[model samples]
Target chain A: METTETLNETQLITKDQLLNQWLGQRKVTRRVLDAFPEKELFEFTIGGMRTYAQLTKEMLAMDGATAKGVATGEWSTLDEEKSELTTKADLLASWDESTEKIQKYWKQISIKNFQEKVVAFGQYEGTGYSILFYVMDNEIHHRGQGYVYLRALGITPPNFWEQY
Target chain B: METTETLNETQLITKDQLLNQWLGQRKVTRRVLDAFPEKELFEFTIGGMRTYAQLTKEMLAMDGATAKGVATGEWSTLDEEKSELTTKADLLASWDESTEKIQKYWKQISIKNFQEKVVAFGQYEGTGYSILFYVMDNEIHHRGQGYVYLRALGITPPNFWEQY
Candidate 1:
């Protein structure tokens, strides 16, 4: 493939591996969301933390926008305002939607794109690869909060390592 | 470089890049640790989450052990029981110590070891590469909890993207 043919000597992980990593993290995060009881997800906050519901919205918005931004090199911020999660169903639906959207646009990205620099949301600057990792990394961070929240609420989060 | 000459066609990121990424993340996480107030570091909990101090200890334990395990392939489980952090000074001191240990041992890991499968702590099965990523990824997750905690405490977190 042209992508492989053009691989930089410095690169050590394949694009496929990175994509799978991204998707797998999302799967585990979705389980954590599913584990939440409807009331506590939005209401539970320790030390003035945002509710898991609120944090999940931030993840969804970033995922959807970053998917587009990485594909098109145009970051959109205005439309990604705080979304309401009236129920666990709403949250899960949004999560699945973003995942599908990510897969869809991920096809448009070429190996060249991964190395091209782009300013995400017209603010944070990174290569296509770093930005993608940033989106995935941010999700993990928020998911950790869910873990803490779950434990505090006396529920066990999905094993973070169970990602496949 | 024997390591580079032996690279699998599937690898896309170099070992140096991964190590730098790992270290850069720790740099940012340390900043997060420093930002916490002495009292809040241990005293704060949201919805029953572990305090930042407790969370940091977990990161320190995992980092120190994983460094050794990756270098020696002898995972040590008995020695990493959380040490007392009577103050923030003690915590930062330990964090610095773990960082040194990771650097010293990272030299022992080669491209071959990364692909070699080993069960971490006699339970989690993954390649050296995957296990290394897990340690870095876990820090980000917990560092995020610190972000929420800081925000809840009404302080802004260090810009996460600032990693060099």
Candidate 2:
């Protein structure tokens, strides 16, 4: 609501700072994925939650495509189904690819574009930054589940605040 | 990592912009909680997820306390267990109170303080912004599940993009 008003000279965060934060959390999440047993990664569910592997696929499908969509204003990206990669290795490979895609596409998004609203996948709509925040938030959401799943299975998640 | 280097001459997002973005998301999350059926708000669970009311309590307990914790280097604040709010109306009231607390405590935190490293609740540690980001991420994670629970319960969630 207040975003429409004239901005002050000082900024809350820089583009690089934001990206670094995202990437750092991503690293922690990757470790969370790795901490899981191979079978549990694909088969385990806690309290009606999806398996970690399926959650990873969901993140993979949306993030890279979502980044591309934001940079280009294309909505069809959401139509792409979640990655079908089954094995842990394959899933990690796909995850790494999406991470790269996010970085590459992120560079294409202008600072001014962050405030422009776009309809993502033709349903949920928000500004470029909000959508990006949603993607990051979505990843953290699933990752948090992974943390719980790990602890339930007697494994500890990676340090969440180790990103420096 | 890049924070150690010389600072940039211009900022990417102002302090107001960041706060506005956070408040906007909080508004969306509140709407999500409000959308739940009164009975389900406390008793409902989808696939092992906490009830919306419980999840709201977790958020309420952490956020305002976290803001206060950041403003002052206080670790004991984390010991304040989540509110035992049983009813939906009570939970919403607690939620409203925390929102106000966040606004009040947030102002006490200096911009420079955001970059300082401190241990929270005698466990997690990170720069001020990273810790704050974790709190926000934690909220969205639970809120996202609440959204799913709503869909499972045959209710429509508030538009996420409406935060603009």
Candidate 3:
């Protein structure tokens, strides 16, 4: 039902929309992290098993992994091994590193290959776009959790829609 | 500087991060939309620009454009001529349509293509991955603006780090 012109336009728009969504999440995450009192970062929990600091650590690890994937042509898999970062500063620093890697790696993607499907890992197989979307979605979910953590700590995060 | 094994692992991690990020943004956007009084949706604005409703309409249109590109494997371009949605319902409906399309289209990407380059219009010309990141980043930028608008309206947005 869609013409070629229509489809082309959609692809471009989709790319932009996804990018915007990720940036918003990043801002929110940063605000949430900053709102936390250093003392509560490690012990704060809402759903019984969630810790504010632990979640942040996971976020850093995940971002690092995604950046690595983009940098290399190969998809990474999670082993039973849990990666750890000791402090907020360390986590933030790692996040910075991952962000750089992600930017560098993204520069390598070509138009022709955006839609190819390769099995990224066990039970996780989809086209390159899907995988990328998945990565973004995962961050958002965790970030939402971070929001809750901020609230429990009696801190108001920045507005979700704020651009700056 | 990185080994192949390390790169592969990072790729996998990146995919997860991307997905998480997407989910987080969606949650925040939904909250922003929900917080708006129905009548205010069409009139809300931070600067002199169009309101959140207007921006959402633009986002939906862009989604269609992005979908077209993925379906046809061609680069999508934006039209110089702009169109606007007249009502909140119209904008909301359009947003829904775009969300569905984005999800569907993302299923078509492959891991090997994450590094392939594409001619993304605008200031930067880079890989598909870069473009994807751009889209995510762009949404966040705009969403942050939405937050400022919310604050101006005296609405308390959810804490950015909340676990919900």
Candidate 4:
């Protein structure tokens, strides 16, 4: 406790800015989601791995669900039933829904809440900030897979740096 | 500015914890980096895409370079001369160097600095926090590529969720 208290105390950035920064990642990720060719999105795979569309499903399930949990102090297991997505359009529509959910639930998180501890998705015990970073990190990790899939399919992916 | 002013301020986590979180990521990425076969590390490409080893070189260059720049208010383009790595062992060694650089430079960052904007690498401009997130996001994105490549070669990747 003394160490925590002694470490430092500063906002660094506002909560809104943090949210916007996260939203920026989501936007850029959305573009990556869009860049996939339809048939390839759901069917293409390297070796026996799942397709990029399948990877996006995991992201869609986590992004909003985890944030909403952090914001409201409620953790639900990943709802695989709800995420039974089939096509790229279905996945994109779900992505948009998750984005809306993020926007709505994000405002519920005061700056103090970011420091509060929570169990993400009913597992992964950590602070809200770490959990948020986890969500973003997971998306980025999978998005990297999407980029590989696109390249393998002879398609160019959206520029990784362009998130705006 | 008004909203920024109104938000409550806190560190949420310690510098050591944050660095560990990043190191945890690097550790996972290192496993992914190691999973690549010798030939596949440099030559395997999906439709003319850069090899996984080449992708990792980009990660090695950016990860430390960006954070070091933020810490010292100095931005230099990636030291490709240093990252002229070829073998997987070479890449992993550079990865370790970057990890050390992250630990060393991370301490130099005060809490207030995370809020200050900087032109990372003399190019991308954003707050210290955003820039840091960018560094992590980039790594995750490319690691995803490594995962695909591993799968394409019929090699199982390290579990994506496990970072410890």
Chain A only: TM-score per candidate: 0.89, 0.88, 0.77, 0.88
Error of 4 at B106 (Å): 1.2
Q: How good is the docking of model 1, by CAPRI class?
A: acceptable
lDDT tens digits, residue span A32-69, model 2: 88888899997987545568888887788688877788
lDDT of 3 by residue, A126-163 (tens): 55655665566556545655554565456775665453
lDDT of 1 by residue, B19-88 (tens): 7777888889999999999999989977776789988988887897887887789997733447576789
Cα lDDT tens digits, model 4, A122-144, are 76788888888788888888888
When 2 and 4 are scored with TM-score, the better candidate is 4
Q: After superposition, how far is residue A76 of candidate 4 from its true place, in Å?
A: 2.4
Which ten residues in a row are the worst by lDDT in model 1 chain A? Answer: A4-13
Model 3 preserves the real interface contacts to a fraction of 0.00
Report DockQ per prediction, comma-separated. Answer: 0.38, 0.22, 0.04, 0.49
Q: After superposition, which runs of candidate 2 have C-alpha atoms over 4 Å from their true positions?
A: A1-9, A46-49, A72-76, A79-84, A121-124, A151-156, B1-11, B27-58, B68-76, B82-90, B105-126, B142-164
Q: Name model 1 segments beyond 4 Å from true.
A: A1-11, A43-49, A72-74, A82-86, B1-12, B46-49, B151-156
lDDT of 4 by residue, B58-108 (tens): 787788877787788888886544445768888888888888888889878
Model 1: per-residue Cα lDDT over A1-164, one tens digit each: 56633443334455755777788889999999999999998798866767888888888888977878878987887344455658899889989998998888887876667656899898888777677777788788889878877887789788977887
The prediction achieving the highest TM-score against the true structure is 4
Q: Would you list the rank order by TM-score, best first?
A: 4, 1, 2, 3
